[model samples]
Target chain A: LAKTTQPISMDSYEGQEVNITCSHNNIATNDYITWYQQFPSQGPRFIIQGYKTKVTNEVASLFIPADRKSSTLSLPRVSLSDTAVYYCLIGGATNKLIFGTGTLLAVQP
Target chain B: SQTIHQWPATLVQPVGSPLSLECTVEGTSNPNLYWYRQAAGRGLQLLFYSVGIGQISSEVPQNLSASRPQDRQFILSSKKLLLSDSGFYLCAWSLGRVEEKLFFGSGTQLSVL
Candidate 1:
């Protein structure tokens, strides 16, 4: 499992774009950068994933540079409902998943 | 579409009592099942995982034990609960390949008094 490092907390206003970056310096060649969002009292929800370069979904976008050591999760036009803890996981196609202390994004009104 | 189910949504148990939490998956076969515990104000810790029925791999060994009686059913149990065992338990299932995305259940909040 590739350990990830992210900010403990971040504050953003509604309607603004938010980007949370995660560092996984030991990322493997086959590892993929995946992000998950978790609201209080609810399970974590999958947001987006990328192996390299950029991958975009209707919900969010993931950017991975050539080094694969770090990645960014971008949420466009955020709202109060997007306030949650965001987790970044790096793993290969055959490894057990491990989650670390996620970045808590607080969307202010 | 694969879905995961876990119960009971919330549990309040006295110390020394036995504990059993169940998790099941639907719409997928031979999926990898995992049990994770998230302590209040903490990150998720992997407890156990199963690659197939009747096979379990323990990640953090403690008073807890896991069983997989069926391909889709995974159970987390304890002979006697401890105060430290109290936390939010989440059940998730993933495809055989890693990073393929995991589907999580609603999760159970256990409060040991």
Candidate 2:
């Protein structure tokens, strides 16, 4: 399983865009980058996933570089309710998906 | 549409007592099931996973054990609970593969005193 490193916490104001980057220097060729959002006392919710390039969904966008060593999760127009812990994972069917200490995004009014 | 049911929502048990947490999935069959533990202010730790009925894989060596008796039922149990077992337990299932996008339950808050 590839380990991921992310910022411990980030601060952003409402209506602003937030980007959380994750570093997975040991990412494998078959690995896919996936991001999840977790609120207090709840299970993490899948936000976006991408193998390479950019993939956009209604909730968030995932950007993966050509090297696949790093990925970014971009949240547009943040709101107070959007505050949560964000996790970036790199794995495939053969690997175990491990959740690291995620980036806690604080959306302040 | 599929849903996972896990209970009891919150449990307070004394150390040395037996523990059982049941999770059942509806609207799906033969889904891959997993049990994860999350300590306060920590990341999720995969405890066990099952690919099919009666086939379970333990991820970490601990006091907890898991069983898959039916196609959609996963159970987490411990003969004697330890204080270290106290944490938020989450049950999740995926469509076909273990690494696929997972659908998780509400989770059980376990407190071993």
Which candidate ranks first by lDDT, i.e. highest? 1
Q: Give per-candidate clash totals.
A: 1, 0
Q: Best by TM-score, which number?
A: 1
**Residues A14-105 of candidate 2: C-alpha lDDT, one tens digit per residue:** 99999999999998777778898899789888898888999999988898888989999999999999999999977774536678789999
How well is each residue in A1-109 modelled by candidate 1, as lDDT tens digits? 6789999999999999999999999888788888999998888999999999999999999999999999999999999999999999887555478897999999999
Give, for candidate 1 chain B, the lowest lDDT window spanning 10 residues.
Answer: B94-103
lDDT of residue A70 for candidate 1: 95
TM-score of each: 0.97, 0.96
Give lDDT tens digits, candidate 1, residues B41-70: 999899998889998999998999999999
Q: What ranges in model 1 sit over 4 Å off? A: none
lDDT of each: 0.92, 0.90
Candidate number achieving the greatest DockQ relative to the actual structure:
1
> Cα deviation of B113 in candidate 1 (Å)?
1.1
Looking at chain B only, the TM-scores across the models are 0.97, 0.97
